[model samples]
Target: MSSKSEERREHTCISCGINISGTSAAKFDCPECGTLIYRCSKCRKQSNLYECPDCGFTGP
Candidate 1:
């Protein structure tokens, strides 16, 4: 496999910076800027705040 393809997919939780990919990660787009965001189940259950890197829009 190419280096890019061999690389493990890593998706970090926007709120906690924890690796979420390959797990029960919740993926959604930021309401304001539409930037894709990933959140782990733990963080989602707790309703952690997430800020959009593109627009700085924050919400739980």
Candidate 2:
């Protein structure tokens, strides 16, 4: 059995607000706070803007 810390948490796309886990999602850290952010391929491909929930940093 996997420990709680080892369990993968569900990630939501910061751009489209869609569930990204188990999909082809891009993962990166918030440039300001190091908070992990996920973006779906659709959004990434379109260069959709995303805001960091942790630091209010917005970018494409």
Candidate 3:
């Protein structure tokens, strides 16, 4: 696989199927499932932005 493909990719949230990056900044508790999921980055450069880097699933 290419280096880009080998790069560390994000993980899909079971609740929302969003990229969580498997990092605390990108993870949060899914009230519907009580499990951590890809959420708004508390310290991200931009707010109100949520999407799956792989699947491109936008937040409702």
For lDDT, the strongest prediction is: 2
Tens-place lDDT digits, model 1, residues 5-28:
544678899989988768888889
> Judged by TM-score relative to the true structure, which candidate is superior, 1 or 2?
1
TM-scores, in order shown?
Answer: 0.82, 0.81, 0.26
Q: For residues 1-60, could you state the per-residue lDDT of candidate 2 as single tens digits?
A: 868765477778999998887898888889889998899999999999999988899999
List the pairs of residues colliding in candidate 1: none
- TM-score order, best first, reads 1, 2, 3
Deviation in angstroms for 35 in model 2? Answer: 0.7
Model 1 misplaced regions, further than 4 Å: 1-8
Error of 2 at 23 (Å): 0.9
Best of the two (1, 3) by lDDT? 1
lDDT, residue 46, candidate 2: 99
